[model samples]
Target: MAEEQMNFQAEVSRLLDIVAHSLYSEKEIFLRELISNAADACDRLRHAALTQGGLLGDDSSFRIRLKADPSARTLTIADNGIGMNREELIDNLGTIARSGTAAFVQQLENKAEGANLIGQFGVGFYSAFMVAEKVEVATRRAGEDRGWLWSSDGRGAFTVAEDADAPARGTRIVLHLRQGEEEYLDAQRIRQIVHTYSDHIAVPVVLESKKEDEPDETLNAASALWTRPKSEITDEQYKEFYHHVGHAFDDPWLRLHFKAEGVMEYTGLLFVPSQKPFDLFHPDRKPGVRLYVKRVFITDDCAELLPPYLRFLRGIVDTEDLPLNVSRELLQNNPRLAKIRQALVKKVLGELKQKAEAAPEEYANFWETFGPVLKEGLYEDGQQRDTLLALARFRSTTREGWVSLADYVKDMKPGQEAIYTITGDDPKALAKSPQLEGFAAKGIEVLLLSDPVDDFWLSMVPAYDGKPFKSVTRGGADLDSIGGGDKKDTAEAEQQDEAAPGIDALIAFVKLTLKDQVKDVRVSKRLTSSPVCLVADEGDLDMHLERMLKAQHQLDRSSQRILEVNPGHAMVKALAAQVGKDGAGGVVEDAAWLLLDQARIIEGEPLPDAVAFSQRLSKLVEKGLLAG
Candidate 1:
């Protein structure tokens, strides 16, 4: 009977400070936020029938309407779906954050995973405060007939009044655009925003556009894409939807058209883009999948709709069942939502495995652009690691190209029990490593890894299929023991270290002198001709990655790496003999420094002591001339 005025919750004021100033990067996000909320209500109505039909109020068709008042400079978003009551209006708007919203957002920021927070909120409704000087939320619950209007200036408090004639079952939000924001009242502006961000929505999103005969005509597909059969939607239409919904120009590399019918009725049309979206790194990039309840547009707020790793994917996910709110808090906990997201992930990955097997080249390009992100799965999601792994591709030791674990498994030696790999900063460099010389001689292939994310992925994807992944640099290289045969050069190195005048004792002497920097100085077990090599201590961080992190974070100091030496090479042999002659001979010390420096150079590393290295180089050249 009477309008009631309410005070803003203590947190509401604090939240207003953040929503207006901090929450979003652009003021336009308010439209996205509000529009998303309206869509969620429609989606919830579409699905509520299966669980408890009373919540939807017999409305089968749900749509969103956009209206503008040129003279008043006002825009309104109205939906014919489930609406909220007085308490809901206050909880949604009067509080800075409901419990779940605050907790999830805080955890993300704490974990420094806020880079993908866009659309992961219920607070998105508050974004309207960013552009509207005056805002009104008029809603009536779907099953109930009475309506209430809550209006706010977004300063602190709000006013709620009874609405005698609130249209049908949904909520209508009106925004009095700020002076400079009056442009949003333009028909063109409205169409642009809806088509750019809401085209693939499962519900109709109508914008007022000028027509020849009528003053205004509804413009936009405003239709659910996934609800339609695959026969009706063309590939070009699908691409357009991807570009519009994802703000991505790259055409999708793969499209997964699926309908999960038996247990849960849902239709999903998802696309794997050929490239990462421009804002893939932005913390506020909106989720590309639109959520629908029984084909009615709901919310696109849950990045959880698709796993965070698949945040780059774009498409529509229309389900007959899911909660109707745009709040990430509810979506995260909702059993139906969690199930759909999990199923979607498996389906996408399974489709990927199919692509990797059926059309290897296409999936290869997809992997190249998205591999590091997918590798992240190996560490974070062990349950799906093997499945995601079946789609992985890598460079082979014997080939100039990439190979899948499946292919490698097929190529393995009869007795080989593990999938062997070697990681370094440079793939080409690892390929040339003396450690691989013995494997090559024995016809064993090692996967070449150059990505910084390689080790991180390897750390997570510890095993592939039934075979475990073993880093070749770690241990049990045992190349000499393998195949019961050795390369001619390996044989010579073992012989050279043994028969070449007093070499075993010399090696021990060199180890004693360089033990501080050297791990273990053994006669060449892997190196055939290379004089010296560096191997990471078994299970320690590999060389290239250590270097990468050091340079990436710009750490002031770095951990020293272990140096491995090749015993058979003449340089090593000569150094050993010289060390045997004089424990602290000036020439021998110089030779020791040279041996370490030479090993560092071959690994593409700068010398730990560069100036001293230059001096040693000069001495070594002089010594050669003096000998001649």
Candidate 2:
């Protein structure tokens, strides 16, 4: 066929521009990307050979070879793997076919370290332009007779043509090195780059010099890093393998390497990254783990390999039992795959539990990085909820660092019946909540849950270790039954009870004045220093949940909250006295609204009427000054 020119997809053009100009911090990463792509091609061929007996044809051995010519200013990467035909070449290279192309480009434009985003979007092939002025690819698909050539300058357009003299099967990429990028033409430099990035690749990477007399050298270990026995793999090897697989620079925080045999045979080399991925919480974030059958790579972005909650986990799961021809659709409903997933989840949670028990400080660090993500399992994976809960950690009012539910229970005061907690968006703000003043006074601990997932998991999991999880901001905390506070508090409570008539009148007056704003008005046992606070009704959504729902545009109207008053506070006492004399006058009415607005402010809620609140405060201050 005659060569045809085509414009790159709009998104692809933008990506090419970024690679050619802006993404220069990691120019060497271009080599890594090409080698990784070559390895993937080899893996695809191996998997295809399982069903199509003739796919391998005469050359069954799969390998990647690199040749450099310093005099010619050229470098070639060749792979004996499944290669693309003419149409496949155009579709794959000329367009951004992925779902999140726009988001990926926006991220690339926004982030300084956006080289990883290219890999995430599967467009690493274009990275060659970082060092090459022009790139050429000649490829022939297995079981096909025709070969094709694709050439591009990493700009607006590319060309595709027929190449009769291409390799029998697989791809060869020739890069015309740009000026000042001649380092890639050295054989030693090529070998070092391959060893650093592609050492864990299962296929052999052979490096050859342009000189005819020099012998070719294998640059990589040419073995699957996970399949090797644990004792044989050194820490540095494991760390390098993690860097290659994860496309990350930091060392792994935790590594789980084990082979599960008997019925379900698989090897898992999972890593918990020391640094969280940039898109860890992105709604469309790609899965990090790859799926392999008998060391033949299948899919790296398969969500079936791990649940969404564990999407941060990066590594490989290679199974010997699964058929090499298994498709992703078939794997989803496959009972064997289900069982494997279940077992893997259990194994990961078990390792985390062991780490928490044996090395809490280390586990705490892991939790600090991934706790919100891990807590998602508590809501999503009901079958493993108990295990996830056991692994959960929280910041508490009683301690300096993180504390687990078990640790909190161990330190619980006598007669404490439930595990108390408070949910908000910030830990520092939660610690200052008026609702917790009473708990602090009684020396009772409260878990400070600030993550958006906190409210969700707590709803799914109401209790841990036989004690029900109680929110300190709820109406049913029942602090009196927990046997807290001192005798002085008891005597004051009795004295307030003797003045019950006056308190009751005050509560009635406040309820009448703020009838629509509050569900009810009552004396608060949960307030020690703060005069007023808001609490969710017995069966209503808590303040945190309300705020979250509103923020998401899911809830339009706020749920009415119960307004509680502390009779011991001077403000409440003065309001009660004024109410007894004048019977719900203007001063008493203003005080009632002021108290509600103040409580809302303390709970991090926006006042219903800020202008009114300011006016009321000004009037009260003026009156106080005149009386003084």
Candidate 1 structure quality by residue, lDDT tens digits, 268-381 = 888888866544544564566877666545666666687666777787888777644445476767788778888998998988888888988888888878886777677677
192-263 per-residue lDDT for model 2 (tens digits): 788777788888999875567988888888999997888988887888777667766567989999998898
Candidate 2 TM-score to native? 0.84
Over 4 Å off in model 1, which ranges?
Answer: 1-221, 281-287, 294-301, 414-417, 484-499, 545-562, 577-584, 604-606, 625-628
**Model 2 residue 135 CA deviation in Å:** 4.6
**Per-prediction TM-score, please?**
0.65, 0.84
What overall lDDT goes with each candidate model? 0.70, 0.84
The candidate that wins on lDDT is 2
User: Which ranges in model 2 have alpha carbons more than 4 Å from their true place?
Assistant: 1-27, 48-60, 80-130, 133-171, 209-216, 284-286, 483-501, 553-558, 580-584, 606-628
